[model samples]
Target: MKTSIATVCLSGTLEEKLKASAAAGFDGVEIFEPDFVASSLSPELVASTARDLGLTLDLYQPFRDFEGVGQEKLRQNLRRAAAKFDLMNRLGISTILLCSNVGTAVSADDALAVDQLGRLGDLAESYGVRVAYEALAWGRYVNDYEHAAAIVRAVDHPAIGHCLDSFHILSRGWDPAAIETIPADKIFFVQMADAPGLTMDLLSWSRHHRVFPGEGGFDLADFMGHLLRAGYDGPMSLEIFNDTFRRTDPFRTAVDAMRSLEWLQELACQALERDGREGSRMELSPLPTMVAPVGFNFVEIRADDHRLDQVRTTLHQLGFTDAGNHHSKPVELWSQGGARVIINRGDSTAGSPAVAALGFDVLDPELAAERAGRLLAPPVPRDRGAGDEQLLGVRAPDSSEIFFGRVGRGGVPAWVSEFGGSTEVTTDPLVTRVDHVNLAQSWEYFDAAVLFCTSVLALDPQPSLDVAAPTGLVRSQVMSTADGIVRLVLNLSPTGSADTAQHVAFASTDAIGAARRARERGLAFLPIGENYYEDLDSRFDLKPEFLEEIRELQLMYDRDERGEFLHFYTESLGSVFFEIVERRGGYRGYGATNAPVRLAAQHSRRPIVAAP
Candidate 1:
């Protein structure tokens, strides 16, 4: 599959964008008009530079407001087209994208649009150029793919064809099945973008909120499947217009765009295979088989040498016992029932205690790492001691390591032997295994991280949610294995805040008993407002004693039709926190409704420091 991206999707000069795209393994680039207009280099120089970097000038984009006008306006538009065609000739580009007119279109009549497009086609043919007419979601007349394709067909010009954009087609709730009926030769170009579900105007959303495929709500696999079934064998280009991507590092954004394309192609291939059309004309790169993890094996925390004692105190207060010390390396293993926490005193100069790595138990560690590597996620290299078991780990976008291990293999079970073995058990503790892990990321890296989790680790991402935060709104998404294990709650921290603390939630059979034990041991619990308890009393018909117990323990509660949830958080120890949770029956959520209360309370206790 050929991949291309628009220059407007990145941040930098036109030259920089071209270099980044080539470096990220894209085959071509669509020159968005504004990028060329702002560049100091001539069109010839841009073309030559792209040639030197092994990139094709795929298409010249965005000749807007070209249809639906009187003869005088139509004549002027043709002249404008002539000028752009002359530029495209200089740049060695053939196809040009003409978006449906959203403004200054006098009529929505199909005959007028056909006539205007035919005139544009005549002008384009003079310069050996092809016109790919696209429907803008908010276009005045031809706002749908069917409408645009009908106009293209009516024009009957050899140089004019339909341009299909996934965002424009899918965002309007139009059925994509009709795409299979359009002849592939008439489908000039395909542009793709994914986006979070938003209840906003189409134009604003299209221009500001677009994301890469696999990071949003669109069923792009199905979308691409129909396009392939239509036999459109052109470059699948990216045309994202996101505010975040525009401000991020151009090289990183380019890499992420390439990754999204790879992931999308794999999904499309899988879809085709499921439909028993494995021998289709569409060719895709080979992908490793996906492996779903069973559950979290352990969580590793890295504490600054100075704060090691404080971290130890917090763990001990929560009823964890020192299970074993690492044979080599300055790491200690703390255990409470089935849950294990590895505290690594790595860098002494580090400012705070933070989550360093997560360990997951999968069926095949080697296979999982192989799949991740194929998806462009290389494993982190670690120097091993003579007896240390090798763990396959990949670094997340935020620089945290995610290690994979399997049972009855040279993985987690073998590594456990380095610690004094199962015979070293002492006293029983309150907390059980890890219920879920909460990772906080900046807005810039959020989508990339989501794609990594889904494509590399084979986790299924749930719908995203926007929760009220103390500073602003926070976006939260959960990714989990198919078997309901290895849950990861990713929090997109609001920009300009130091509230991106990492957390681990441990499951407890009796939340009240666990709370009392921690309290007696002097662990500082984040205070809850009395108003919360009052509201809980109003919401649920809990017994008076139960309400009083919740008020005394400062716990948070949420209930649904399936079950009830009770949880409480620890005061922030630098940039790390902890949660104790008790899930009654089949509660599948993370108590997102109580997030605002927790945020307000955390803000009240800690001084505000903006995130870097």
Candidate 2:
């Protein structure tokens, strides 16, 4: 099923939000109330723009304090509701979010609240709109998903339904199993937000601490499993209210959000598979005819320098053996166990080694390409043979090629069986797969790339961010495929100069350990100030040693109630730098808190010549 995110997830104005949503692999977006209120674009115009960008307005939210209120307040709210409904109709939005009363009327009894909700539901029905009633965790009363669902059922109106928010449900320590009991039809919407678990006031925490999925500690896989089991097929909108996210580059933020969602998708897929759910199995098209004997096959890196040789040497020292060379490609293979790293000495002049291409082996390359093409654009063929093409290819946004070919049957290299060696084994574990790739692009090409990934590659768009410099410089646009395997970040340079892509981040299972290992290897990293962590006790109940170590190492951090993330940046190499991240428990986002620091470092290091 197609997935959608709230447009508010993108840190920008309404127009920018729509563009970012389209780019981020989102099938649709929930239009937040604030964006609509602040937008100069008419509802019709906004709807038209959404259509032009190939986005659906999945929801129009939120009508707050709609249930349990005084006569005068009720009248005022009804009028506002009517106006919003009209606007939604103009904007071609079918779903409306009605948040349960928070402050004033939350004390009202459930009966009164249900009666009020029924009236609003009847009104919504009049306008041909469905009302998604959401329970606020901090509400005066009725602050749980089951409770909200009960109210909706009590209201007994087709137009009234419950909106399940992952944050509210999990943060309140509610049982996720309750999801199974609710009728699937009663679920009008599903809102998701990941957070690092912390001992702080929920109000302050929810407003400032939300992160993207996979970056937090919540068991979102289990939550999604429950929903899937209940047959919920609705848009899972991300509603994060992060301080750093709002301040960072919108495009990059959106890309990060999409990546987080992609990770969640993978987790969900795994969970569903474990549960033996029908239609949950992920069968790679063109099953492998010859498997590489259940061992590490290869690890690929697209780099410029002999530095890649150093990386290879490091891998060798760690226990990998040289495999073989690609006939025409600039790639060499190294392997140990079931893992392999393919080092590509392809144009690393672009600064960091971005993933230039991915080569996968399948049973039928042609059929794999065909299935992929049906989902995305047809693969761009790169190699032709005497009788037929040897492999099938697809071109990604950065002009990199993704190739699929047969590997084992007559495809295995003679060197595969001859290589044997036991290299040094360190206690430190290397990163788990190339978690994701980040690409840099000019502003103008951003949307086109997003469209290519979404329409041609069949990848979903994730959430995004809008970043502006203190000098009022704004660069934006980010997109990623669903499943978080690929990410593309676009920047509209303030000076509008064309330059090669810079900076690439690799994921690590243990950020602190990686940093320590790198430090021991004599690599210098930027330091995080002590003042940031001085208030750790007040903000989070973390252990003193852990907090002190993080502060001393200059790690940046942010968390919600479910998980925490720690990240540190390395010295800039030209325009690029590296970020090492470690997620503890439910964390799922890159540390946005570190963006300003990284950008500041970049700005400081940039050569300063007198203006001509």
Residue-by-residue lDDT tens digits, candidate 1, 250-339: 998998898899899888888787655532566788577866877787899887888878888888888888877778877888888767
lDDT per residue as tens, model 2, 1-612: 465777666677889888877776677888888888899999999999999989889988877876788777888888989998888889999999887788668345788888888888888899999998888888777788888878888899999988888998898889897887888888888888888677898878788877777545678878877777777777667888877667656665666565555555655665676774542322212211222111112334666775665556544433345666655556576754334456677665744545455555445566656644543433685544233336567765456676655555444523333333344333445554333334566543344355444433444455555454434343444445444444445555554442323444545677776666666665657555455667555777788888878877767777866688777766644444456666677765555555555565556555668999
True-vs-predicted CA distance for residue 446, candidate 2, Å: 20
Q: Provide the TM-score for each candidate, comma-separated.
A: 0.95, 0.56
Q: How accurate is candidate 2 locally (lDDT)?
A: 0.65
Q: Write down the worst ten-residue block by lDDT for model 2.
A: 287-296
Clashes of each: 1, 53
